[model samples]
Target: MMLSFFDQFMSPTLMGIPLIALAIALPWVLYPTPTTRWLNNRVLTLQSWFINRFTQQLLLPINQGGHKWATIFVSLMIFLLTINILGLLPHTFTPTTQLSLNMGLAVPLWLATVIIGMRNQPTHALGHLLPEGTPTPLIPVLIIIETISLFIRPLALGVRLTANLTAGHLLIQLIATAAFVLAPMMPTVAILTTSILFLLTLLEVAVAMIQAYVFVLLLSLYLQENV
Candidate 1:
């Protein structure tokens, strides 16, 4: 039976057990835990530097109250970066390709920021539903529009990640399939296609890293507004 291209996005199962949970858990195992030592290897040193830089950039605009989120944000950034890069490997399934998983990651974090805003600064939080100096006639319409936009943030976060990753995966698969089919029939064309595929793979690698960062960065922006 011929397999469908879209089947790649489906969560893999082994012997009736879904691997999505394992995929999510596996990234933590891959991370190098810091040991108690003043000195470290080059890899560890580089990892620390990257994390510090990312945290600094992410928190620069937020208030001190939001500074407490540094650990959570850093953890999230690493977790996402790991999974996204891991998914590019052969025989691996990408958990983030699923909208359900993406939304699961997104909605709670997004909701937390909203809840923090409401709990700590109720007036300011609610004020986001309406702008200053609104005309009397447009008040209701503007409030409705802003409210819709506010709630759409989480959905946008999830969909943006899912769409970008899914599109990249599909493109990669399509190119690989074409190259495979053309190899015997047209060796020259197949080589050219494979060359293009190689470049696209590199681009996808960058996309994987970037999409993860963008996801976390947008969350920080939302938290900045609230805090």
Candidate 2:
């Protein structure tokens, strides 16, 4: 008997060692490395094409200085894309579903952008705390509000990724269980539920891809402001 649906979100373990570490590292191993040859393999060619296109589209709006982050952001986007999709497979654990793992990724990168802004343009960074043409009565309140929002950016990033993935997974599991139980009692209802599950799976696939893009895109936006 299942006690809680949330239990599936818990990090799986083997021999008292958390398997989330292995899941995190698995994406790198799965990627095909490029070989030095006159003609590259299809996998290597396709990988290069995708990365080039993604980097070009992602960094087009940012300044020259922000272009330096192209490699970091591109790599992160691929890593996230891989992990998010892999979690959809049967019996697989998704590290991104854990708020701790998401925050670990979010906080450092977000902090780096903030630090860059402060170090490179202190006046401009502080200037964001208060908008131009503000009334004297609201200046203090606005500053406090902006400061809180600034700090909340990382939290929002982590929570957004976690919530989207977690909700999709929970719904999938819930519907699957219902279909299983209904199959024995009412085959027609079970078939309809199964059909719905198939459509939901397709939607979840799109969500997985989109959430990965949104995560990296927001990080790039943060870097844009600082650089």
Candidate 3:
């Protein structure tokens, strides 16, 4: 029986237990813990530097009140980044490719930002549904449209991450399969395909990283509006 290219996206199981938890937990373990020593190792230094820079850049557009979210933003970014890159390796599953997992992450965080906005500034939050200078005739229609768009935010977040990762993985698999099948019968063609595959792999690695950053960055933007 031939397996689907998407079989790689499925959550792996061992016996009766799902390994998704392990895959999610693996990123934390792979990171080097900071030690008490005055001089840190190169790995720890690079890790610290990356975290600091990312947090700084992420928080820049956010308000002072939204600064409280720095930790959550940075942690989620690192977690997603690690999972995404790791999934590119042979035999690893990409959890973010699953709509369920992406929505699970998206809804709660997106809702929290929405809630904060409503709680902190009810008038301002409600005002977002109907912008200023609207013609009386179109007021009702505009509010309805804006309200629908507001509700669609979380769905957009979840689908964006899932779709990008899933598309990249599928494309990689298709190209790799082509390269493999052509290797024996058409060596020159296989070589050209292999080169394209290599470049695509590099592009996928970048897409993985960018998608993770965009996910976290959007959350921060939502929080910025509320704060």
Candidate 4:
């Protein structure tokens, strides 16, 4: 008998996700070190000047003085990258393929773009929301189009990651499942498909990294452009 989707959900490993999250979060929660001090000083052995250069641009003034949003950004990228890359293991799956998870990462960036833009340039941000020199007769049409595009940026970001990563993962899964089903009947064919699928899973890991880079780069660009 073939397995059902619900059969996979019933596995004990599903509980591991929360445990993994706790493991990853333990440093920040229990030990509670400053991200700037932790990452800048020793995490990657990054030089002080290098850390200062990036952190200066995004320092947010808080009660303790300037907190490094730059470090936070780096942390976020690293965490997401690890999650994606680790999914290539035989028994693991990338949660980035889940729409809810991808959107959780994306929606904040979208909101941050608007918030930072407005904070940096109050009057100018309103103007930047629409293009310059609109024809009087077509101003309404132009506004509508630009507004839609602006809103769609984050939606596009979410869809790109969710669709591509999920599709690639599902393709690998189907190929592996096929190989398993055929193994007893056609040993040679099963071995060939499984070999190819394993290679493809490795390729998918590279793709995951590329997607993360693209997403983060685009986010940084939006910050620079709007601010």
Order of the predicted models by lDDT, top scorer first? 2, 1, 3, 4
lDDT of 4 by residue, 1-227 (tens): 76764332221344354444443443334222445553444534543444465445434322122142466566666666666776666665566666777788888978787787688677877776567877789888887887788788888888898777777777887888899999999999999999999898888988888887677656666666566
Q: After superposition, how far is residue 145 of candidate 4 from its true place, in Å?
A: 1.4
For model 3 the local lDDT of residue 184 reads 99
Per-model clash counts, in order, read 0, 0, 0, 0
Task: Please give the range of 10 consecutive residues that has the lowest summed lDDT in model 3.
Answer: 2-11
> Any runs in candidate 2 off by more than 4 Å, and if so which?
none
Off by over 4 Å in 4: 5-68
Error of 1 at 194 (Å): 0.6
Question: Regarding TM-score, does 1 or 4 come out ahead?
Answer: 1
For each candidate, the alpha-carbon lDDT, in order, equals: 0.94, 0.94, 0.92, 0.67
Candidate 3, 208: how far from true, in Å?
0.5
TM-score of each model, in listed order: 0.98, 0.98, 0.97, 0.73
lDDT of 3 by residue, 95-203 (tens): 8888999999999999999999999999988898898999999999999999999889999999999999999999999999999999999999999999999999999
What is the Cα-based TM-score of model 4? 0.73
For model 2, what is the error of residue 118's alpha carbon versus the real structure, in angstroms, after optimal superposition?
0.6
Tens-digit per-residue lDDT, 1-78, candidate 1: 989999999899999999899999999998688868999888889989999998999999999999999999999889
Query: For residue 135, what is the lDDT in candidate 2?
Result: 98
